[model samples]
Target: MTASLVLAGFGFGSVAAQEDATTPRATLRIVHGISGGPEVDVLLNGEVLAEAVPFGTVSEFMPVAPGDYVIQVVPTGQPAEAAIVQADLTVEGARSYIVVALGTPDAPEGRVYEVNLDEMTTGMARGRFINAAPDAGGLDLVVAGGEPLFGDVGYGDASDYIDLPPGTSSLDLRGDDDQVVSPIADVTIEESLAYEMVAVGQVADGSLTMLTLSTAVDPSCSAALGLGGAIEDACVRLTHVAPDSADVDVHVNDVVVAEGLTFATVTEFVMLPSGEAQIFSVTAAGSPIEEALITTDLGLDPGQAYEVLVTGDTEDLQLAITGIDLRPVPAGQARLGVIHASPDAGPVNIRLSDGTAVVEGLDFRGVSEYKAIDEGTYELQLSPAGDDQSVLLTSELQVTASIVYDIVVVGRPESQTLAIVVLTAPVPVQAEAIASPVASPGATPVDASGG
Candidate 1:
């Protein structure tokens, strides 16, 4: 018998399919949608449902006893007692569903969606669309040179189910006035299978893209995102901050990276290939090749993001490079970076109000890389070169999952007015690829980064 199982009380999830009363079992598939999260194992009532389900992996449908089941997702190989996302899942006999492990890893939110598969015949394929872009406005999607497949789709909205001829299809997304926003070509859809196509991330940052999910195996789907949305290399943005510096042109190994850039201008990140050292050069806006002003070398690692900010005065230039980790944090975890930016402060150590040292002997304008920790209100203290008892500055911060923060020393240690400046910025959307360049007042924002 055909039917749709609505999870009205259990998080309002919906499951649609046919029921086989004689079998007395429910069919289930799962999709791993938590970006940056580690592989996870799904369990029901202390029983393993699936193991080591990695990011971007999908699972097929399997039969299970129908009733109210205690559902949980934990790191692969961990004990069942340790769960990351837990919920109560109800499955009716012979029904089917797609349970998706989504949201940032630190604050996971799993979703249950029921799909109907009665039209799996004559080489036909079933599909639906979802909009997951964080800030994209209404969008129009169409087949290559064909009628609209999805029109005016808003953020977080899913479209009606559709039937299409199985195989690879070329598609493109458009904004207002039908202007092409992104191209999603060469997507393959197999016959006799159900699928969900999603457009997720921020469009302006070049991370807005697509993914095609299939519900056959226990939790199966395609790649993370396309339309060139996912950045697989080191990312960097340059900013020019010297107060007395002229409108300068920047270069990386003789190639003009950004030209005619004025002070206080922070350019959007320029995608860079990782695993190599880069030579950055600066010259007067209209200067000749041989008369460059300054140069610096920076090493960028793969699967990470970095920032190179030009600091100090126009005559004595400096480059401050810091790495930004966009990897998913475990559930309930947060990340922080401490920077020593007090121009006149001597080498100082960072610590907590309770006398725990976090950074040691950091010199003027130095920085501590980002580190993960449990979310909480941290009372920070700056001491004289690791001497926690000699607290110089203090600040309290409340951190949350998937959020990054920069705790900066803003005044001279010897100055009675010394204090800590806590700057907070949003995590890079799904791409999570960005860096922050900290600049004090009387300075500008010209770093190969932002904020």
Candidate 2:
């Protein structure tokens, strides 16, 4: 064998031994000054040679082939754009190297501003602190670039001030219960601006709550009622019924119809035309319900349909008056058709209240076909719930004993608004039947002479 003493390179054959021996390895240490750590990765010839190491931690890898290699140090979970440091280093076989990872530059913390309200007058200027995030709590209020305005109070209840600034300004509200800060609310300060700070919790409450009572009638005949006629005047009664007393106000078309009605509960009234439709709104002090107007003037005609709606503050409470058709029936009785539309698709209770007793046993769902009701001076009301529930409609209807009449109740799509239409026949009829029922039933029938 000519004494061919094969010199195994590290127990490998000579050909492969030279290649394995020439391979070079590197070790890197990534460091960061911030609380979050940095990640480290080693590459050979632009190819990743090992798994990434945890940030702010040290990791070791096997020797890599000696050549120009790149070392990358990046923040964990961040892309290459977020790489804190990067370097290209040359490694020789059997040699060791160390790399130090650097951290990103620090960002400045935000400062707070102080609002003083010591000189503000109560009731003269109403003030309250609202967070940008409706659900967030505690926010810190302090003097910009200065110590906290309120000592020891930090950014909690004592930090915010209201009704002090002579003008309105954006304010940051910190929650006392948690580390939540409200987005800025444009607070108008008309009284004093440079006084002691007021806690958000101490602000006066001025929110409004609304209750609605609605009913529908034939638009053609009822349209005249909305114009304020004695024959078509209607009223909606909203009772607070809540244990706590409230200041109630009623509005129609943004006009204040009633205000400052203080009671444990309240009753509101709205007038609608006999063949017209409209929206009514009720507001109660210190409630979250917004003041809104219901729609009247539903474009209804004979043989057409419409709806009337009543909505509550709670999302779960909604009432719809649907399937209202206007037609001319005989005098003594009027044809009234209505459907209670609800998401639950359940039955709705109907009641005819004469302002004293309630007539029960009336329930409907979806589309209730047209039915004839005896005409008289009556208040027609509907409630989704059987007893003492919110009213969907409350209005007076006068039916002539001999003329034909049609009433249609229509519900608005995706809204708690309703439209009522009343249709009347042109046919001449007995004057006694058309006369107001309020006149004594046994009294002599008066002639048409301006009686």
Number of backbone collisions per candidate, in order?
22, 75
Top-lDDT candidate index:
1
- Scored by TM-score, the top model is 1
lDDT of 1 by residue, 275-350 (tens): 4567778888988657888887777764344555565555577767776544323334446777665556688887
TM-score of 1: 0.40
TM-score of each: 0.40, 0.23
Per-model C-alpha RMSD: 18.3, 31.0
Relative to the unseen true structure, what is the C-alpha lDDT of residue 407 in candidate 2, on a scale of 0 to 100?
42
**Weakest lDDT window of 10 consecutive positions for candidate 2:** 1-10
lDDT measured at residue 162 in model 2 versus the true structure, 0 to 100: 38
lDDT against the true structure, each candidate? 0.60, 0.33
lDDT of 2 by residue, 1-451 (tens): 0011111111111111213211212222121211233344433344454445653333332333446544544434444444444444444432222232222223201111221212224223323331111122344443333333233243212233333324545544334643323333443433211222223221122111111101111222222112222322332323221112246554444445446555322232233322343334545543322643233333222222234333323333333434333322223344444433233313455456733323233343344555444546666665555554676666676755323343433343236544334443321111111122121112111111111
lDDT of 1: 0.60
